[model samples]
Target: MRELVFALEYEPGCNRVADALADHPDARVRSLSLHATAEQLWRVDHATGTPDALDAIEDAFLTSDYYADCLATEDCGATQTTRVLDRTDDTLVLYSDWERTPSCASVPHIARDHLGESVLFETRHEGRHYTWRLIHSGEGDVAAFFDALEVAVGDCARMEMLRTADTTASVGGSDETQSGLSPEQEAALRAAVEHGYYESPREVDVGELAEHLDVPRSTLTYRLRRAEEHLAKQHVADERLPEDPSATR
Candidate 1:
């Protein structure tokens, strides 16, 4: 589930639309509506959980000038699948209903008007099921504004996911190198192993070995990790690498 802000062009006291809908038998508590702006309508729901008939409801609102344009079709009604169906002239619908199944827990929130004008919103991603309204004081296409907003929200989500993955890999040895080190680093690693630098006598602390090799401690650790990874890989490739193939010969 995600939260979304809606920027509408309604008159004062028009915020009751959501409350009225809430009284309906079909409305879900998770589907909340609030006024973020006097002219706007804010709504929230599970993007992936909504019914397929939402587009029809949206079309209903759009054709009716945001519900402020007065009801035309006698069949203008709502179902559990239709959370909002407006018929007012000043009432515009701004919604966030994009959903993905087999999806991550995150939802994208958006707030824009019919002319695509932007309204105030919190961070790049929608945290949870939320609905709020914003008054679009500017002149812009609501659809275009929302399109851009969606793109921005999506980009932010991607960046956050990538960053989280990178951090996790760094902390958990996720990016084990094939060679376990660059050529130079591997040379140092071989030297450390042969010199018994990593053995139990405490003959060489990491810092000491790093200094002896004229390399930084950080560099030594990195090389060691690489070396370990490489050796492990080689052990898998040639099982004899661990017991000294030269000794057997």
Candidate 2:
């Protein structure tokens, strides 16, 4: 699953920040890693959530009136909101050329130190996008936050203009391509594999498999529907059926 953990540089003692986000109908903040001057919030969301969630959150931090007014607008260049072109959390420590600046310089190092484990997501400025890493205290699905950032940044005036002007470039397809299958669907596919249900005359019992998994049979059926959709759309070959059964039957 796609995930992110960004350290939003916010004012000290601003409870409203988290509150404002968690209260959003489309987005919710799962947890927050806070300190005196800044707080790093972790969020996760289902792949089915709206397209604008992550952009919104990014806008709040990048275009914050407090920070923008302090820095030279010229250095700001063009702000862009790149969607989740790709995301990964592996054993490797990925670095980026967007080094720390006077305003955001300490952020990367501090975030790395505070949250040892991190995952980076590709972001776009106008349409010119780059990669940014998010550090986390521990492993948590922070896809929710990234989705929010996408929504925030998409609406951001400065960032929107940057993207429109071709200042940002993305690497891959949109989130729809990135989303493979839901967790429930995956479980069903696994059950189908283990139970050997798709075989010949000696077919496995769906109810028995559902019982083994401790899920309702109907739930399993629903999962199978999703699995079939993914498999059919992706043109994944069904492994259990070795031959065209209708030809023989």
Candidate 3:
């Protein structure tokens, strides 16, 4: 079984959160957890129910054909829960005590209907095209699972996989083969330099960089620091490599 961590973007104006975040580009959603059912738990930065901020979100819920329920606020740390109705054979029935009674609105139900019930949704991006970390147990037909996902996302939703990797504890891949750092670490440095984030005046701040990179500020900062440290050490090593006695006449 393999775990696929990827990014995807959906058609805007199709969902409450997607529309809300689209209207407010500066604000974004991160740290998402999608359950076995359609219920999803996610945190949106700075979308604390202000009229202009959540206008799209409220409008979507009100007009959606599917029955929907929302709980949002600063006290809630800017979180939202979406449940959509399903009347097909894929309808989900929750057996876990930790889960809410089976609801029609859960997105995971799409996967559950066709991909078996062991799928996991770890992280997500809430922009025009939503990004997510979807983990499947590999117990079902992989091809069918994705096909079902596309249907659930709707024809208007645009989705794609950003990257794929097998499950293991450490981060080892092509990046480590060519360089000592992981791919994410290298990306962090690139993002920092590309946006002039390292300039004296700093055109972009760490928070903005984090939002753009779809990672937490601390995560972004750590990767950059680690990448820089790897580079610095490599520089010192490269300079000293030729000083050995083997290089002397």
**Best by the lDDT measure:** 3
The true-versus-predicted C-alpha distance at residue 41 of model 3, in Å, is 11
lDDT of each: 0.37, 0.36, 0.52
Better by TM-score, candidate 3 or 2: 3
Span of 10 residues, lowest total lDDT, candidate 3: 90-99
| TM-score, ranked from best to worst | 3, 2, 1
TM-score of each: 0.25, 0.26, 0.47
Instruction: In model 3, state the lDDT of residue 203.
Output: 97
lDDT by residue (tens digit), candidate 2, 139-211: 4433444443443333321111101111132321122123355445566777788788777753677898789
Winner by TM-score: 3
Off by over 4 Å in 1: 1-181, 239-249
lDDT of 3 by residue, 59-94 (tens): 454454332222111122223344332222322111
RMSD of 3: 12.4
For candidate 2, the TM-score is 0.26
